[model samples]
Target: MPGEQQNTSELTVEELLHDAAVDSTDIEVFLNALTRLAVHNLSHPGEELLCGITLLRQKKASTVASSSDRAQKLDEIQYDYADGPCLKAAREQVLVHVPDLQEDARWPEYRETVLEEGVRSILGVPIAIGSGNAAGLNLYSDEKGRFDEEAVESAQQYARQASRALSLAVRLARHRDTEADLQAALESRTTVALAIGIIMGQNRCSHEEAFDLLKSASSSRNIKLRELAADLVASADPSSAGAHFDR
Candidate 1:
């Protein structure tokens, strides 16, 4: 879009996504479709497309794309070192790219790292998450002067799609984790409650006092209340008496 003339392309991205299945397994399909479009620009005169999204981890960079290994490594280095384009993009929620890493001294550490890896140019675009933190995409090139203004615009268009895909993936994963946690918490609470009840009967104490006793025992002995409950349940009868439970 920025470097190439806008009148030429035939297929719109919406049409492509509409055609492709928008499921977990089909995400790669979307990525492939977008990249194919960018590749087309690259082949024609004055056009190039390099795009990629980071994996959905760390909460900060879920759907963003990068052009090369150099760019990804730059992101990791930024994460570890606490400085770089990825951090800037995440913080600002904007698109960023360096057409010539050697020429830009804004981030010397990143520049040096990519230079060492033989990368000359790079781009990063934010993946949105309905007004929240999402992943980012980075595009890189081995040759300098590969990404001009028009190319960056095309990459940005593709990045929008990547962002949506990333958001879907991350939210789904988070939901699954939340559901699992809720289930486990419910079961654990049942165990703890049962154990508390057993302690109340054994000690002839009220519910509040039973809870206090359990807390005191757990703290002093440094054993988890859940495990203590399980042991109490497992032992049953008189055999449970004075069973030394190590923390």
Candidate 2:
């Protein structure tokens, strides 16, 4: 009904995701907003549709976002069994439709479980994120044959429009993660260097000797190098109570 009343097409996927990302603090929150928008725009009058997004990166599958708790649970059921329509669609980069779960013989165990959840119809559309990543847009409905040919086409088209935005989001998330990792590495290196300097001052040893001493202490104590370095720095400089590598 919402899709019928308004021109949902007026809002491009890129714009939708951009708004979501701007309002969200992280990728997970942005993805959650994306699923909610998909459900709102795709559901018809009196037709309760549940939506979920499954992301597979480096061969690991995870339910990244869902429209509701029920949708999240349904996606988890598929992950628990490690075989379901969404996984199939994502892995093969294709659309999978189950008009009637009771009649669909594929994934018998999953079918039984989803049927118990009152989901009679399902649709899974692949989302092309990147080479090492795969994703799927999963839709569930209580009425059998809810996703007819027309509905299937709409879902497919939505997936195509959203895939580019999803890819960009994933890349931005990776970039953020890389930046955080690099910052952490730099902080850790700085702390360790400070610790080495302290060791050299205390023992009047060379830089290499101080490093060897720190390494030996870390090995003997069975503590992480960074943690030991942080502790040493903290002890030497009481003013620096909380070192960068404390975390």
Give the best candidate by lDDT: 2
Backbone clashes for every candidate come to 21, 0
Per-prediction TM-score to the true structure, in the order listed: 0.66, 0.89
lDDT of 1 by residue, 118-236 (tens): 77887766667553555555666777877788777766776675455556655665676788899999988898898777777677778888888777788887889888777776665
Deviation of model 1 at 106, angstroms: 2.1
Where model 2 places Cα greater than 4 Å from the true spot, the runs are 1-10, 22-25, 237-247
Q: Which 10 successive residues of model 1 have the least lDDT summed?
A: 238-247
**TM-score, prediction 1:** 0.66
Clashing residue pairs, backbone N/CA/C < 3 A, model 2? none
What is the per-residue lDDT of model 2 for residues 1-247, given as tens digits with 9 covering 90 to 100?
Answer: 8776435563666588766665555888888888988887789977789999999999999999999999999999999999999999998999999999999999999899999999999999999988699999999999999999988988887887678778878887888889999999999999999998887777777898889888888888899999999888877764443322210
